[model samples]
Target: MRGKLRHGNVPLRGIAIVAILLVIAGAATASATLLFLGEQPSPPQLAAPPPIPAPGPEPDHALRDGQPGEVGLNPAPIAAAQGQLAAGTQPSPGHPHPSYAGEVSLLARDGVVVSRQATGFALRYADAQGPELPAEQQEKTQNDTIFDLASLTKLFTSIAVLQLADDGRVNLNAPVADYVPEFAASGKQKITVQELLTHTSGLQAKIELWRLPPPARLPAVLSATPQNPPGAVYRYSDLNMITLGVLVERMSGRPLDAVVHDRITAPLGMTDTGYRPPRDKLHRIAATEFETDPPRGLVRGEVQDENAWSLGGVAGHAGIFSTADDLAVLGQALLDGGTYRNQRILRPETVRAMLTNYNTAFPRNAHGLGFELDQPWYMAGLSGPHTAGHTGFTGTSLVIDPGSRSIVVLLTNAVHPSRTWGSIGPARLEIAQGMALALGPPGHDG
Candidate 1:
């Protein structure tokens, strides 16, 4: 401890003590510098991560064949619906004749096809006045029987227009005249494409385009005028869709039928759906009304609407024929937000827009683009503020209920013998009600 220091006047022991103190001081300084530099002196304890939110319920599965019980449906009602449909093929006391000659119905819930039934005959009448076809020559309704969709064709036309809008090829808010300059004539300059879609364009409900010479038909529709001021009221008009069909053709540079097939049916794998189905498919096609004015006999495998026939089996208001299964695919596609079998024909937003009620000004007629919304007259028990569907004059009806994730497709040849047959409203109500009842209360598990 009394030894001398090597280079300083301090004793060796004192020097050792000072060195120790300095070393300790340096360490403290280094720690302070680290602190000043925002370095952690030690790894701090971390908080437990917030609990991950519980996983939401599973999404609906893809459409497939399933029993009623598997999808929370009561089979009794579904069977009853089938019974009613079968009964409809025979004459009732109130009505001396059948409500419809034949029908094919498909019902699905949560993407499961609970029932697909075919009843009666597709080709029953020999003529509009009667004389039943020989049983040997009659074609029984099949699940795949193609039916004339009538006004339901408007839904396709609407989809085509919306697709154009989605592609940025057409503007929904733009005037029709902007796309087809001839549409501007006769004070139609202000009629918007949306107006046409929602049936607010004030155009006449229909015109005898068939009466006009074939060359004049298209021109007449292009230059047609409004019956009332644009958006003044809601009047469902074939002219609207007819005009839109022309617009689709012009914008897509393809025929309307081709566009629907390539973009819609083909993508959905709907093989039995199209305008002017191939000759090979005629055997599976349902016969519609036997017309006299046009002198079309036994209208089998041909369009039922006169104007559509006059237009070469392709028109917006009516023409496309389809089977129940194909339409069920379409309904599911919409329910799944416009996709089926991995094919997306419309964006989810476009689907939402198509389902949204646009005719708030006209309460009685709630329309969404081309779909009739909350229409109880045809939608029956499934009718709701969000339920969307359409009726074809050829006795076809499609009901898609978003609330329950259900679809009902009732395709009938109600006009097979004649258009004078009574309304198929009762049958439409029965099937839809059956579906609604089969679904039971919400949150019910099979």
Candidate 2:
């Protein structure tokens, strides 16, 4: 009787378990359909994270000498650039080319000097013919070697004019005659101060000032006629800066050099940059050109521009001599919006005006009040509307890219043997491109 009861209960229990399993399967299918149709259950909530803090300001505005990696620059590119400068000294037989005899290049990113190199000989020189010289006679270049700034002197003159404008001593829009009455002699009364700064003043590109007697050069420049109507064309003229230099002297009742020293260089602490470097510093000066016709042999320790040389090595357009380090300070000041080491050389608004494009009429020849703007030939990848720079005939160049707050100073004695040697423009662009590539992507908006 017990065995029969157990068998009957087993079938009843199995049927009840099967019914329970069917209910669970139906419920699971319903859940799967809901999940597949994008109807999943909600998850538990948690608090969101706090916001990130804003970055602080940089420590200083002055360029602090540091390693490339310290400023987030790649050292390889910079080293490669230095290697190129070193190779430039050697002559390749089949492909003989003109290159720097000596170069002092400095690259700065956000006011931190990442690379500073001096290569080749400051005086590995030759006479006007530039034949290779004995090594014993050569003077190796140093970081502090003084270089003739050449046409880069225009930047100083431009800054001085803008400084005077800031002081309310002159007006940018005023006619040139307003400051210098004699400047009106050659139908130039219509030319404005702005036109001279922008190189659209229509003045003749240059006069053989060296040909004229010392007393007559100034008069000739002042009385010279325009090549075209004022602002009607764009032609770079040394006479424009020369005339402005004279205007600076007349308006300030002081020499142009004195005004620049007392106003710009002194305030910026640029001790090695000025007109007529002292005789004591002559040992560190780079040799430039050997002019047989002019009887200047192994030109060194003096201004290289003929017009400036004729003017006693003190002119508005060309005359200033500077070291790579000294120029780095000036470049930093301009990149810092006219202030460096707590000294303000120009008002912020004035700096903005200086870097603003005043030459929309001459698109290819973009210019600021005292700087060249967006020049790809020299500025390279750093070229932009706000980029500023100047090139000197003596193979010196300064490029400041406001976009990156980066500065490149490439000083070469390309004119050492002779100005006839081809241009260093390609090398100039290379140095700037190396810096731009090293900085690479400008990591932050700050």
* Cα TM-score per model: 0.85, 0.85
For lDDT, the strongest prediction is 1
Question: Worst 10-residue stretch by lDDT in candidate 2?
Answer: 17-26
What are the lDDT figures for the candidates, one per model? 0.78, 0.76
**Candidate 1 error regions (>4 Å):** 1-61, 442-446
lDDT for 39 in candidate 1 is 31
- In Å, residue 270's CA in model 1 sits off its true spot by 0.6
**lDDT tens digits, residue span 1-446, model 2:** 00011122121111121110000011112322222122343310111111111123322477788888777777776777677666665565553645768889999887788888898888976676667688888889999988999999999999898888777787776787999999999798888887899898889899889888999988999999998998888899999999899989989999999999999999999999899999999999998888765667778888878889899988889999998988999888876667888888876556666666666656777777768877766776566666789999999999987666778999998887888874577678667767766665534322
Q: What total of clashing residue pairs does each candidate reach? A: 0, 0
Report the C-alpha lDDT of model 1 over 1-446, residue by residue, as the tens digit: 11011122222111122111000001112322232123334321111111111223324356789999888888987898789888889888777888899999999998889999999998888778878988898889988889999988999999999888777677666788988899999999988888899899988888887889999998888788788998888999999999999999999999999999999999999888889999999889889888887888779888989989999989888999999988998999888777887888887656766776666667677777788887756665566655799999999999998777789999999997999984688788778877766766534334
